[model samples]
Target: MKDTVVEVKSLDQEWARLILEAKKIGLTKEEIRAFLVSTKEL
Candidate 1:
């Protein structure tokens, strides 16, 4: 799988959407952070 990098100037609406989605699925902050770091490693 290829990785896509997204650059955002601020954590506003886009970040809120992502956080909301994660929360809706019951993902903890640590889980989200670990998932992000793991994806970076890939």
Candidate 2:
């Protein structure tokens, strides 16, 4: 999981953008969240 204190100042906007992009790419919320988590680990 990502550190909670990393600061999500633009998280809402970021998430909104991600959701829109995901929709275009046919990605579901679960897939998006998993991808985020996996990327964070890297």
Tell me how far the alpha carbon of residue 35 in candidate 2 is from the true structure, in angstroms, after superposition. 0.3
Put down candidate 2 lDDT per residue, 1-42, tens digits, no spaces.
875764476877887797799989998878888888897888
What's the count of clashing pairs in each model shown?
Answer: 0, 0
Which has the greatest TM-score?
Answer: 1
Overall lDDT per candidate, in order of appearance? 0.80, 0.82
Judged by lDDT against the true structure, how good is candidate 2? 0.82
The estimated TM-scores of all candidates read 0.51, 0.49
Tens-digit lDDT track for model 1 on 6-31? 66656466767887899899999998
Worst 10 residues of 2 by lDDT: 3-12
C-alpha displacement of 4 in model 2, angstroms?
21
Highest lDDT among the candidates is held by which one? 2
